[model samples]
Target chain A: MDTAILIDIVKSGLVLGALYALMATGLSLVWTTLGIFNFAHGAFIALGAYLAWQFSSADAWGLPMVPAILLSCAVMFAIGALLHFLLVKPFERRQDIVLISVITTLAGAVILENGLQLIWGARSKQIPPLAEGAVEFGALSLRNSELILMGLVLAILLCVGLFLRYSRPGRSMRAVAQNQDAAALLGLNVPLYFSMVFGIAALTAGLAGVFVGTIRFMSPSMGSEPLMKALIVVIFGGVARFSSPIYAALIIGQIEAFSVYFVGLYWAPAVLFFTMIVVLLIKPEGLFGKYQRTL
Target chain B: MSDLILDVRGLSGGYDTTQIFSDISLQIAEGESIGIFGPNGHGKTTFLKTLSGLIDPWSGDIFFCGQRMNREGERGSRKMRNFNYGAVTRRRIDPKAVARAGLIHVQQGNLLFPELTVDETLSIASTAARGRKGWTLAEVRELFPRLGERGSHKIRFLSGGERQMVSMAAGLMAAPKLLILDEPTLGLSPKVRQELCDAILSVRRLGLPVVLIDQDVAFLEQIIDTLYLFDHGRFSGRMGKEEMPDHQTLMDMLFGEAH
Candidate 1:
């Protein structure tokens, strides 16, 4: 393999890993707190991208690109909270909440997808890169958008990691995740934490959506691919810790890039899933996960 | 006499459709510690749980800091009540509100978040010390030097004794007017239990009211001024530390009720 091409592929893998990490972070969070998968996550991404495009485009809100994306993230947070209240919390105490919430969130996903289509039209849209052109590092030329995307993902993950590790509210969320009864005993509002987790999860997913729209093309169904990748990353990493899915996502991204390089694009996912199954068979908890009480 | 920090009467609670204990009443005055001794699967834990608002009482009242904590009302739909299901006007207890009101419970077995560091657990719990002068982090760290040494380690990775100490320290961080221990020393070795007993004695010295439940009457007698022999979901007998009956008498009390 050419050294330049190898470097490019490796860089692309890192970028893909960054994207997967962002998407999986939210999914991991919702799963940890609610013990339910947010099926609407993909739709949230699609809608988030569409929403940012609406705000940032010269035709609509005419806002700056960064502000537009941030606004879209805020809106998505509300949508996430609404979805939780309407679709998720209703079956919170049910014995089959894990099973039932899937149906509710799937229904919610359909609603969000159609709503995005109705509002934004079915046109494949894309967000312009944060900047035009690529930065040159010796022989390697990296696109400004991909580099920015990785930087932004890293920054967000760092902030969230710090928050969960240090901040009081973050600790409360962990408390709720680790032991709801214990959290309640400490006077931490469990329901409030639930809403907060849903909101923050959607916020991260929305940011990922914005980037996905920038990197690829946005359609109502654009989030499906990223959602699938995100799920694989989350489970392959571990469902509990915030850091596990991230490292797993990075490894999964490298696998995806290498597999796509070696095999055809059609066989990439098969290879990915096979790799995940192998990792799980061995570790069970996850690649980076410890056998601790799940969050 | 010290002011009554907790007053519970006619407290009956259990899981859905099954009553664990009924009309169990107790009072804890400020600076007083009470102990409950009973066999496994009895209502000792349940009683402590009901008082801390971890579980709702089937029918009872809980007064914390002289504030009416649990709202007594008919739960479920009126139709269910008509069918004699949950017909008793149960108490609606929010554990958060109860804990905030300073009724803290150091629950038995996996009480603290397994993934959180001891420092994080204590700091987060300290947030519950609302509207009162609670212990500072420095004070809590001083209270449990072991916790200070193991501040960075996750609760799951800690030894059983360390975990129990962290649990108690977290409870103290809640600035509890009254603390409830549901078998804090249940599974510890004698050395650990002795360490815990010393810690509990230190807490007692700190003048915090406590309600302790343990299988070890000797341990309970060491800390609690009043001992209640709980059996079959009720306080079968009550004795002061001074008048604690012999082992044969205590066994007769337990066996007398079991049969």
Candidate 2:
């Protein structure tokens, strides 16, 4: 490909990768810390997109985009905590927690989709872009909204990293994730930590939804694609390796963006999936995960 | 000297429908150190777990610091199978609650949060011990200087001995009235084991009641003030430090004389 085309593909890839990283990080946290796959995570994203859409609507609450995003995140956080208390925490000690989480979260996904459909209707809704114009450099054009989204993703990631690294509750979360019984003995409130984790995961997913919704459009079923993308990124990055998601997202985004230029749009997702399968088969730990010890 | 910190009576429990141990009773007084000895699968760990509220006793009464313990029911079980079905029973006395109640339990295997720094781990414990006038982080660090040196290091990188020290620090931070340790020296070198024993004795000197369980009779014989030998999930015998059996007799009971 030409240099200009290559740069364009690279730019697109980086943008997509930022969004994917944001989306996948939550899935990784839920999987690694709580051992919950959280299929309903995508549903939270969908809920967020719809909330953002509603915020921008003249007939609705008509809030500013930033506040709207924050409000949506808060709502999803509460919802996530509730889901944990009602569904996740109850099944925490079950050997079948994986299966139960999948089924329960799937049920949540269905409920969210149908509920959105019933409330918002099945029509596709578009969010007002954060910025309207594009920056042209030679043959490559970059949208201002994309840049803003990328910055937002990076900021969110950094904030989460700092919180987990420094905050008392965050440290407790890591402890509980490592060993629940041990965490308890250390005086960490295991259930409260679990709730906090769920809330954080939901908040991240919600933020991703708003970002995606502003750049593109939202439908009740829009979650499926991003859900698949997040899952792929998490798997590629290794569920236990939090930083891996960002790197994996970059790789996947670059491959998809570059391939779309030559092989067409449909082939991009195909290539991403193919890469994921190869990684899973060759290095089951993903690109960054270590071999987990199971008792 | 007769103030009982932990009083477990008629405590019986097992996983699922099976009864692993039955009619178990034990008492720990303030500042007293008790060692639990038993063969594997005889419910020694189970009994400790029951007292810590990790596992429920089938039928029993547990009184901690003179208050009754809300026992675990079928619904509150932490069983993996039951959890998968979304049936987690709320802990009546969760680990935090137990710690807040001035009782601390440290189980075998390094239970440090791999991602947290030693300081952070100790901080959480300190916060939990807020109500109780327990040892401060500085005091705990003084007790384990290695912990003070590695205070900022993540748990995953620590040696087994260091991790145990961190766990001990976390427990001690709470300034518990009763401290329960299950197999603290499970996989440590002899030197580390001795250090751990020293640490346990130090906590005891601080006037904390201690309950210790170890497969090694010799190890307990060094630091324990009292001893309870468990056989098939019941306390087969109890003895004071002065009345304890000779090393040979204890070893014969623990592992049996070869042939």
Candidate 3:
């Protein structure tokens, strides 16, 4: 393998990993807090991209990329709060909530996806890059947008880590994740925090969507692929620990990059599925988490 | 009575369709530390949960700090409705609001997050019920010296007594006006129980109200002056501090009766 080729693969893998990390963080947050999978997560990512595009597109609002991303996150947060109250909270205490929430979120996802199609149409769209041109590092030349993508994603993930560790509200959230009853009894507002968790998930998911639009392309149905990949990362990372899925995302990214290079892009999904099955068979608890039966 | 810190009337609450306690009533004056001793599975913990807003009452009123905290409208409506139906429509007490109003419930089994260290647990607890000036980290450190010594150790690594200490410390950090403790010394050895009882006495000295539920009558006798006997989901009656039973005598009465 050429050194330059290896660097390109590593660079691409890191970029892919950043995208997965952002998407998986949202998925993992929702799952850990709500104990229900948000099937609408993919739609959330796609919608975020679409929202950013609407803000930044020369054909639309034509805002700058930074402010557009910010607006996208804010809108995503509001939508998350609304969906949580309207769609998720109603079924929260149901004896079969785990099963029921999926349906509700799936309904939400279908609506959002189709709504995207109705609004944005079926054409593939890409957002304006965060940075134009390419950067050279020795023998390798990297797209400036990809480099920015990796940096921005890593920054967000780092911020999330710090927030959960040191911030009072974040610690309260961690407390809830550890024991809901305890958190509530301590006077932590469980429902409000649940809504906030959804909001955070939406913010992160929405940001990932914008990245996808910049790095790849966005269509109404584009969210499904990334959503599937994120779900795999969450399962591989497990819900017991907060940082587990992050490392899992990066590892999966490298595997994906290498596999796509060695094999073909079309066969990547098969290889990934095979890898997931093997990981599950060997360690049902996840790579960094204790065996926790969620749902 | 200075003020009724917690006043309960016609309190009927339980999990699901099963009524664990029915028409239970109790009162605690300001700065009053009370003990509840009951046989296992007789709704003692459920009563505390109901009071703390962890679970909603089927029919009851909880007046905390002269404010109605628990849902007065519940009044048997939840019981009358379909099973688990209240999950959706039962708009009962928001435990967070209850806690914020200065009533803190120290739950059973310690319930501390296994991943959080004693320091981290206290740090998070400081944010809870932030309306009141909580016990400073220094104050909590003074109250539970063991916590200070092992501040960095995760809860899972702590001893049973240490976990209980962290739970109590966490509750105290919330600056609780009324602290409701459910089995603080459930499975501790006599030495650890004595240590906890002494620490609880220190809390009592600070003029904080406490509601203790424990099988250890000896431990309760050491701290609480008035003891309530809860049996079959009702308060059998209140016992004067002097009238509280010894451990062996209460044990015989509660468990050895069948044998």
Best by TM-score: 3
Docking class of 1: acceptable
Better of 1 and 3 by DockQ: 3
Expressed as tens digits, the lDDT of each residue in A126-149 for candidate 3 is 987888899787798988888888
Off by over 4 Å in 2: A136-140, A293-295, B72-93, B215-222, B251-259
State the TM-score of candidate 3 restricted to chain B. Answer: 0.89
lDDT of 1 by residue, A1-295 (tens): 6989899889989999999999999998888876789999988888888889999998788899878888888898888888887887756654677888899899998998998889888888888877778889987999887887888899999998898778888888888987888888878888778988898888898889888888788899998889999999987888656788999999999999988888979999999999989989998988887765366
Question: Candidate 3 docking: what grade?
Answer: medium
Q: Score the docking of each candidate (DockQ).
A: 0.49, 0.53, 0.57
TM-score of 1: 0.91
Better of 2 and 3 by lDDT: 3
Candidate 1 residue B95 Cα shift, in angstroms, is: 0.9
Poorest 10 consecutive residues by lDDT, candidate 1 chain A: A88-97
Better of 1 and 2 by DockQ: 2
- Of all native A–B interface contacts, model 2 reproduces a fraction of 0.65
Ranking by lDDT: 3, 1, 2
Q: Rank order by TM-score, top first?
A: 3, 2, 1
Predicted candidate 2 versus true structure: per-residue lDDT over A106-184, tens digit per residue: 9888998899999999888878888888888778788988888888899999999788767877767777787788777
Per-residue lDDT of B1-259 in model 1, one digit per residue for the tens? 1388788877878876687988878877776789887788986777777777777777778887688788865246546644443224333788888888888888887557887788888888777675466777888777678888898998889998898888888888787878888888878899887888888888888788789887776777778888888889998888888998766678778887554
